[model samples]
Target: MPGVAERLTIDHVGQRGDGVSLTNGASLFVPYTLAHEIVETERDDEHPERRRLLQIDTASPERIDPFCTYFTRCGGCAIQHWQPDPYQAWKRQIVIDTLAQAKITCPVDPIVDAHGAGRRRVTLHARRGSDGGLRVGFAASASHAIIAIDACPILDPALDGALDAARALAEVLKPVSKPLDIQVTAASNGLDIDVRGTGPLPTAIITALSRIAEAHKLARLTRHGELVLMRVPPVVTMGSAQVTLPPGSFLQATAAGEETLAALVLQLCKGAKNIADLFCGIGPFALRLATKSKVTALDSDGGAITSLQQAIKDTKGLKPIKAEMRDLFRRPLVPQELRDFDAVVFDPPRQGAQAQVERLAASKIPVVVAVSCNVQTFARDAKILIDGGYKLESVTPVDQFRHTPHIELVARFKR
Candidate 1:
């Protein structure tokens, strides 16, 4: 049985998107509650500083019925109750506050909302139920419990029936009733799926999977880095180039989000003839930049680099683009190598690129556009650039992951 706890009034939303309240001068973080809301909460059994919301006594005016039936039960979304305008403003404020902590202040542009047709990719957890059947869906918030979803509104309509797809595959691939992670990506041809957490498939399983692929007309099926079959190539269009995605390719969740990020990047690096795109995966920005300038794209992933090279060859009208495999974290282009480029664009992973930024700081590159999804790391990197005599030009917040606390941004720095 759950224990009874004190009633708490939520004061504000914390940095991690949790509702914060003070009890006897100690702070408690509660999930699924909003600022100025009254709720009954108890100490979380798993976390010391956390409180589990038991009842909402007073709700915020911003609250609304979530579009998805599985809002709080699923861990994907954080603040779906917020109205769109307030949500956008809050996202921009989060960026501003994060940058302020690093003492870098610049104009923050209005956020670009790209919650388009819906997310093109999703990874669901599949496990065997007690009844020996399969359970397929997202995990519950901060728990291992999987919440089976019949329909997910945030998914692209093309992926609306993905749970059924996952279940069908689980039924066929359940060799020993183990849990699996089904990663599905919607592509130009059809669904590109990757199944993980399973052992080597026997010949019979492969034959059955091939039959499933044929029946569903799947674009491609991959099992833990091994290719099972490809009914058709999984291709994605970025600008004029059509990229044949390598299995487990990193793609923006929605097409509009990619376009928005690319448009902002192009606008920031305008008039630059020579540009180096560091950590460019399959040329989301470099391929588009090639239309006007000489571009050199580099990434740690050989597959991403090879895909970019092939796309450059396939596209007819793009300017010269050179793709190479280089790890920015390990061997970031030093100052001498960076001196050749008029400007540089880098979109690193959420950890940010401190090593690469340190090198850029020592260089004389006239313009630099830094794309990032994490603000804390982005702020640290921005400080490095600013201390190197770079002017903080503009910060544009991009709402690529809608309803989630996650934020993407493009920062322009010029020296």
Candidate 2:
């Protein structure tokens, strides 16, 4: 295939920050080519691959050295090469663009950085075999091939060793016998591991894992400290109260992130006598809020609701709180259902709270706090709230996933 000889000028950055342009009516996406930069390109017609930048004729001021050695090969983060300030500004701009596309007017507050941020709770992937041994890492960008990594700088230090140890253990296990899926989480005490597969692990494999665990000084967890391992639920302590989380139950990944989110929820409540927390997983925010006022916690996850109920029972001096399992996606809280609450808070999934936002907006709730991981979805939902007569008060962007395009945002709106 012949490489294009002319120097191509980058017009602008796309959603993923790649330089986007058109060549003979075909879309070309060239990475590391910033807006206004000129570059030589190669086209792979067979793969339908976008034109790839072969040489840079000019560089953009926004570029910077990526901190990670594996930045290009590793698929976990896309924008690490960009300067920090411009990167953050671009993220905020995307949020603004989404709202603008929806024709919504609201103040986009400056992004907020959390202390000790970038702590991820759960990571999922498959194990790969290499000539040296077994290798574990994130899948390549837009591909299923595994990209081996020695260390991930973004994760909490404690959780770093878990991946290395897991890879080592995979080498010892029989090629066809071991579980393909592994999940690791960091707890207050130590690291926890969950291996999921078709059947029970062989005795030899378990012994090998145990030896690896002891050698690495990985925390030997108790039923209370390890929720992901045992057949029965794991017990978690909140203040003086103890709650049990069933296997596969959702919990906040980092103690810092949870505390930050909880504090924000309380601030948004702002002394409301009654508050409704939707999709309140394990009462992280709802339980904390119960100290100040009455709270109604609702979630579709039965295990989460059960844990929240147990928490309410164990803690004293908490205001009246109720936990219910309702699939908000299918049967969202109607306007009449929300009539009794003065304020509402929602922390929905990446898809954002489309159904819930519509229902909440129709309810005419005085205050609404919407937390989301996806900025585009958050902006869309914010528009819904604004259309319902609530004015956007503030937006705080939390960098929960550093070195990546992923952003966590908390938006407050008042009627």
Candidate 3:
């Protein structure tokens, strides 16, 4: 039997933005809720810690109407109903609390609004329903089920046709019956679409996909990053150089996010003559940093390194850039190799740069700027740097994935 309805008061929002309450010494998590609000819900019998919010008996002043109809169902954005001022503060506080837990003390600046013009890239899932119809959209909240949608409000205006293009391409691949993951990016040339999960296709099917790409006016189309069709190279402008994005290459979620983060890194390394960029994906920061300083960019992705090398060749006036393909986790620059650089900037993945940070802790880099997407890992890495005689200067949180719990930050360290 379903649990009976009950009234609960939300104590506060958890780190994932769920409203939390203490009951019987255990935590109850309710979605789409806020602190100090009373809500009527029923606890799931199978999942006792979870509750389905039935109604808001007493709404908080911070609550506002969600912008998207699929806010709760799509699972893409959380805390959309909260007021902006408080929401921004909550994001900044997340960093503050995480650092405190790591016993790290420093000035954490306010969160930067980097969700400019909305997300420039989006990955949509394509699945076929039991009724034999194709469904293309994001996954439902907390489930693998797909929620079909035609438009997403959080996408940039440039990606207006991304969903449609994804649908058309998915339709051609429907006969294969394999679930697909389509990534669409708004490039300077045009929309770049990459279709994944479909194994090798017959030449006829490949031809069909190419025709669909042409019909949709896609700049390029790729299957598992192997070129399927190409009308023009997908290019993106970063600082003074124009980078041709490799198929499915890593890029900042929002265009403004890249600019904001690069600006902060450049400012921190103001007087740096030579800087080393570790985990440099496609040279988002290195390209910009090179405008005034020499840069050595390194990443594990050969495609990204090739793209960076190509971008530098086309653009002149850069001091010097040596883009290399090296696995930093296996071979972090030793102190001897790091001695030549005046400043070091590393923007690592969500796992953080544990291996590289360990090496960095052993080094004597003068100025180190760390860019990260996960707060927990950032704190861990920051602790390592602090243990290595680095002074924690300042930290700034950048909110590029707006309306979600995801946050990115840039931290400056000095000796």
Specify the highest-lDDT model's number.
3
lDDT of each: 0.89, 0.72, 0.93
Candidate 1: tens digits of C-alpha lDDT, residues 283-385? 9999999999999999999988988899999999999999999988999999999988999999999999999999999999999999998999999999999
Q: Between which residue pairs do clashes occur in model 2? A: none
Model 2, span 284-398: residue lDDT tens: 8888888888999999988789888988987898989989998999999999999999999999888988999999889968989887878888888888888888898887777
Clashing pairs in 3: none
Full candidate order by lDDT, most accurate first: 3, 1, 2
- In model 1, the clashing pairs are none
C-alpha RMSD of candidate 1? 1.3
Q: What are the runs in model 2 whose C-alpha is more than 4 Å off?
A: 2-7, 22-27, 44-49, 115-117, 122-124, 129-133, 177-179, 197-256
On TM-score, the stronger of 1 and 3 is 3
How far residue 237's Cα lies from its native spot in candidate 3, in Å, is 0.1
**Which sections of candidate 3 miss by over 4 Å?**
1-3, 45-47
Lowest summed lDDT window (length 10), candidate 2: 221-230
